[model samples]
Target: MNHTIQNLEASFQDVKSENSVLKDKIYSLNSSFYQYNFTYSDSFQRQKQFDELQLLQQQQDYMIESMNHTFQNLEASFRDVQSANGVLNGRLDSLNSSFLQQNHSSVDYITKELQLQTQNLSLSLMELNKSRSEDIETLRNIIRSREQDVPKNITSVVNSLKLNDRYLSLSLLDLQNNISMIGTLLQEQQRIQSNQHKLLQMEIQNLTYSFNKSTILLSNLQTRQETTVAFTAGVCNIPGDNKVFSPGQTVIFRQIIYQVGGGYNPSSGIFTAPKTGLYVIFCTNVAEYHETFWTKIMINGSAKAGVMALLRSSNVYIYQSASNLVVHLLQMGDRVWIQVRSGNHLCSDSPETTFSVVMINGSF
Candidate 1:
């Protein structure tokens, strides 16, 4: 029994010791957990504050940089504006000086010139007045002598001759009415003269054109001995081919194409000279009544020109047409064209409108 009790006591003491050790370990764990939680919370708060402060500093730096950039640009712009203003001011000063100088010089020059002219005019007027006074005095004396010595009987004879002579005088009696009439007549005469001059100029121009054209044609004919080309145009049939034409209805053979040939109709047509000077081309168109058909003497295509018997008043009613033009301005070996124009005309007693031409000789 004693041994059993002793063993039980020892076991009881070991169980108590283990309970104490476990309680101490639990207290140390609780304290460590509390300290760790406090440290973490404080650190978190400090980090948040630092981050906010850093963000604020960054924004401030960005703002400062933008303001600095804006200041630089503004300063450069201000400098440019200042330079431009200075230049403008210089130009304005120069212009003002130039204008002032020019204005003064012009005014002085004009004043001097006007004064000189006034003096010359005054001198001239004085001389003119003196001469007029002398002439009036002499006339007065003559009149007084004539009145004293006149024979009344001869005055009538003198007056008769002078009566018609008064019509030629350049004098005016009525200032208002006659002046208006004279002005109107002058304007009318001026207008008539202007129109006449214009017409004369036009006529001269037309003659000149014709002369130039003729001269050129003659030159071409003489110089260009060889012909270049030729072509055919067409033929015309007017009125009725076989029947007589009615009044106002004349038959026409128009646009006949003719080619260059070696010679004329050796038997039927004769190429004649029309003027004294150089002429070119040998061409003719026919003019006839329905009873007889007109025949054209053709050359090379459409350029022959000259005078013919068709322009007479008696041949006015004769039917005539434009034939192809024949220009024979070429060397001996050269070619030309023969073309016919339109063929038709108003039927009348004499309605001939034919064109013909020929070259007589070379140039002067």
Candidate 2:
């Protein structure tokens, strides 16, 4: 009986030791599970952020491609317009040439006709004068030969001479009237030509204005298409374990996630505006527990926005984060940066302290 009781007590002691060991194993497993869960959560968050960034990039690419397609269409249209204008100009030049040729030919024909008419009139006048002189000589010879019948013959010859004189005066008056009519025709033709030249000048001025307007529009569109700006940077594993900055000190984000149009400089911790435009800026900062982090977004040495991360609790191994966003108009050559305001310490981990800037629209 004593031996059986001693065996039972030994068995009980062994069972207790085994139960304690199993409890320790369970606790260790639970702790490991918690650590793994935290790691998974952190990884998931990072992946989410990465995905968002990729999505943004893809959207930007799509927009750029669409803009390029639109620009191509515009260029094609402009080319067509230019081609049509050239055709119109060619037609106008041909018409103008035809008009000038017709006008010159008409003037030349009128001048030649007037000169020929004048020569004919002069020849007729000369023939008439020669006929009159011959008649007078014949009459005189008759008068001398018939001196006995002088009175009757003389009266008949005088009547004949007066009739010829009246006919000559009527012919001279007709020639003068013809000359006056030719002068009037020339004046009317000159006036018509002047009016046509004025009309052509006005048409040319209108076409020139339209062409200049189209050129300006195309230039503006091209400028808008060519301007593309976006960048994201972070402070990842900074050297020497010093992540603090004095007041008015700029925060340098050494890790470059992405950059487009080349405005952000990691070394200088500043972004120079490549073009005048409206820009959207985002900043995030992280600080350790029991500390405060203060930062501001600066443009040309002036603060545009600010954020604070205050973790005053007596908690160890914890962090607090703050973020700020600003939309501001920037001119080309303007400088932008993030500066420390009050508290100086910032986390050096990737994605925890980040700054990003993107151009929204260009100035008109």
Candidate 3:
């Protein structure tokens, strides 16, 4: 009986030792499972980030294509405007040339008419003087032949000669006055035409100046529009450590690192685009220990890119981080933000979570 009792006690000790070893093995297995869960969660986050980046690249390519199309349209419009301006200038020049030619031809015609009239007037005066001299010579030969009756005939002939001389003087004076009037009229006409030509030239100059000014203004406006397209912003950290967030809640990154061409509102956790352009956006977030969450980069409440951080193991508190990047074409006043798609808690350490945006190109 004593031997049996001792054997039973020995058996109990062996069982106790075995139980202790099994407990240790179970604890080790639990620890290994926890570690494996953490590692897998981290790896999954990284893979999601990579996938998001690829999606972002495709979006960027699409945006570039759209911008190229817009540029082409703008260029075509500009060329059309330039062509129209050239046509207008050519027409104006042709009109000016035509007007000048017409005026010059009119002046030449008037000058030729005046010259022919003056030649005819001089020839008529010479013929009248020769005929008067022949009549005087014939009258003198007749008077000598009739010398016996000279007293009565001489008185009448002298009176007739005096009357003829007065008429000739009056005709010559009238012709001179008519010639002077014609010359005065021609001078006045030329003056009027010259003044008209000057006025037309001035009007053309003014039109040219106005058109050039408009062109310059348009060019300056286009340049300013292109040069003023700039935007960049970066923010980091949540307000507190291990902050709980509900699905669809925006993640407010309160700390502003830098901002240029400002459009970000740190308090509201929203970024409004100030100009139409292609923009690159990135977000990185860490889920609190023992939490699984989905984070999304949202534009106007629509998801553009997303990342998931999942921790499946219970009693295993390991921080898991995920990141995503995207490129988007944004119109002015479009809003963007980061939101919790499905999450409970987020890591709120500085530099551990961040959001950033930058405009890569401006659209016309």
Candidate 4:
């Protein structure tokens, strides 16, 4: 409302300024008449009246021009704002796409890198034992060299081989440690990537919420401006009179709520729906434009619009199967209720007015 008023004020100011300018222009364009034999008082009064008429004419022209200009400006600005909003939304979508693509690529690359690392670690272990055949041959040579031919340096030679073996063992241990470190690093990276993905998702969700809120705000503002057609549900003075009905799904009333099946008890004025399905129950009172309490289906105790009803062409049968009972069930605690929708506003003077429910075999 405030925004609408502000725009109107701005438009009015522009028109006023334009009107003043047009008046000045018209005055400048007009020629001053000089009469040789005219009396001063009468002639001056006639000239003043002519000038006033011209000024009024100019004011009219100014108003028309200003209205056109203001409308054009407003239209252009609205278009620009819409364009900007679209671009922002597009960019946000692109960011989401980029994030998903990036994560996918990262995962692929990480998998490849891990595979390569594993291969290299295995190769390193293989290389470490490549000289096993030569080591075995050297030991055999040492054994055949005999006790008699053995020099005093033989002990030293054996000690040297044992030292080499110890060195080889330490090297192998170091290589294994390197492989383990690489595995740990890769695992750490995966964890970090997962956390990043989660953060991105949270940010996207927040952005979506903000975008929706802003869009709704803009729409509401626009709606409040320009034009609006109001919808007012007519009132009926049923002080305490109310209603209920059930097939749990389908209930139809021409004028009065029959409360058919297990839940519809016109006498008690209470409806109980046992199962789930479309229920079309309506009320007739001294009201206009607000009729039909057409609730198609009640799942458990909630109303479902029957998204598949159109496809399935499926509907339920509602009738008073028992004594003042509609399916012996209660249709209560469901969403999509119009205060004007619960069939009727029960008159406080009436006995008890409520809807009931029970389980029944029906498809919707």
Candidate 5:
């Protein structure tokens, strides 16, 4: 019984130690779980604050962009206002200049009229005063003569003198009325004269304006005549044998492109001037064989200018061209043409061989 009790005590001690170890492990696990939960909650709060800050920054960027757009719009509006102000200023200046011109003209006219009226009135007043003085002096002299010749009776003299005085007063009144009428007539005459002068100036202005219009129209007419009556014809590759031409013969141009004023004749190879004008004539000729080619520009069968070209033969047949040009003033119905002077084997098929005439100007 003593050995069994010792064994049971040892087993009980081992069981107690195992239970203590398990309790310690459970406490450590609880502490680790609490720490993890606190750390997770702190991290979530930090993330929420960061998201709010990013949203605020984006709103600020949008507001800055909107403000910049508004500033640009304001700038454009300012430029438009400045431009309109400048245009208005220009218009105002123009109007001011016109108004000043009209005002100056009106002032000048009024001043002239006033000066004329003043001069006329002064002369009229002086004449009226002189006449009145002369009439008074004549009346005084007549009265003295009559008094000397009157009877030496108080009653007769008083009665006759009263009648004479009354008649003299009436005549003076009539003279004053006549002077007033003359002044009125003078004023009317001045008004009529001013009106006539204004009419004359307006007519003169109209005449000047008409003259300017006529001058412009005349210039335009001359320009139109120059452009409308212009004639140009160029012919190339006249059909002919490779034969030498005489000096005065006409080079018949076969092709006719344009012949204004019906001046060119294909059959006779003549360009007749339809009107008196200046003409530009040109001719070109090419020689295919070894020969000296000569061409002439002529008017009325008279040579005005000439050209010559020499084509020398080599291993290959060499060809050359000759050209002549002349500008001359010709009368109406004058003939102008080109003729080969001394050439054989001329290149008639080539376009280089050409005759051209153009009337550059016209007279009357």
Candidate 6:
């Protein structure tokens, strides 16, 4: 039993190992599934980010181009104003000479206004250049930050996958251990059943030995009682030829032949016990050629012993006989008889087919 248990444990371990390997394969498949999804999703998100970045970069470039165009337009407008002021100054100088003191006050006021307008335009150009430089610097900083964030996000995703893989491996190991434990429990159950069967066999052997001892003691007691016992004997004789019978039908004999006691009843084909005792019952079964028949010794509608006969259908008209002898304990009033269990044409051509019962021992 110990060896069997060990072998079972070894087999269970092997199975556990195989299951562990399968779990590893399953984990690998799951990891692959997760990886595929992550890759697809990350790639999609990265593509979207890249598209957004590209759009931002394009917008920045367009803004820069628009600023450059505005600066050029501003420079052209300043140049046109300078040329117009020079021509106007030349005309004012000619008018002042021609009108003398009368136009001198008006020329001075007009010159001052032109100088103020030129200073305001110069200040606006300087402010526009500064704003453009600041915008360019801000765009550069944004590009640098986005480049740094991409690597950080990728690393985080990879770490999460590794963590998931570890968890799956641990769970698989636990399941494998659980299966191994269940296998051990099953082995214990089988060992228990085996032990129970052995115990049952030992008990049966003890009962049989006790029964045989009691039977021998009873027989010895009957032997001592034999001097005071009355004798009882009965015999049946069959003389018909080619008698057909069906299954479960009693085999009746017309002649009691030699019954010394009132136990035998010819009409009912049965014998009732006059006293409780061990009795030896015997039967001789005869069958026709090429026919098979089954005969059973019955007690109160239940068969106790049986015999089967088969005869070879040869040209010589061969007859066959099967016999059975059984010893049974019967109580007073219990009936014993013989019946045909199976056959078609069963008969007795002579007095060879017979049934008999004799008391072998008296009740103890």
Cα misplacement distance, residue 205 of candidate 1 (Å)? 0.9
lDDT of 5: 0.61
What TM-score against the true fold does each predicted structure earn?
0.17, 0.37, 0.35, 0.20, 0.35, 0.34
Full-model lDDT for every candidate: 0.42, 0.68, 0.64, 0.41, 0.61, 0.64
Best candidate (score: lDDT): 2
Model 4: runs farther than 4 Å from truth?
A: 1-161, 228-364
Local accuracy of candidate 5 as per-residue lDDT tens digits, 1-364: 2232344344334434533443354345335434533443334433443354345445434644544453354345435445544654565566566667787777676557656655664454445445434643443454344334322222343444445556767978999999999999999999999999999999999999999999999999887655543334344454463244665566676667555566787777778887787778887777756656787888887989987876555554667777778888988898887777776556655455667777777754
- Clash count, candidate 5: 0
Write candidate 2's Cα lDDT for 1-364 as tens digits: 2232344345334434543443464345436434534443334443453354345445435644544453454345435445544654565566566667787777676557556655664454355345434543443453344333433433443354445545656867998899899889999988999899999899999999999998998887777557878899988776664565788889888788998888999898899999889999999989855678889999999999898887766664578789999998889999999998888677775557899999998753
Could you tell me which 10 consecutive residues in candidate 2 have the lowest summed lDDT?
145-154
Over 1-364, each residue of candidate 1 has an lDDT whose tens digit, in order, gives 2232244344334433533443354345335434433443334433443354345445434534544453454345435445544654565566566657787777676557556655664454445444434543443454344333332322432343344334424333445668899899999999999999999999999999999999999988765443322222222344433324332222232433343422222122223222232334433344444322333334332333422224345445654433444444333423222322332322233323332334444342
Candidate 6 collision pairs: none
**Candidate 5: stretches off by over 4 Å:** 1-248, 312-316
* Regions of candidate 6 where Cα sits further than 4 Å from its true position: 1-242, 312-317
So what's the TM-score on candidate 1? 0.17
Better of 1 and 4 by TM-score: 4
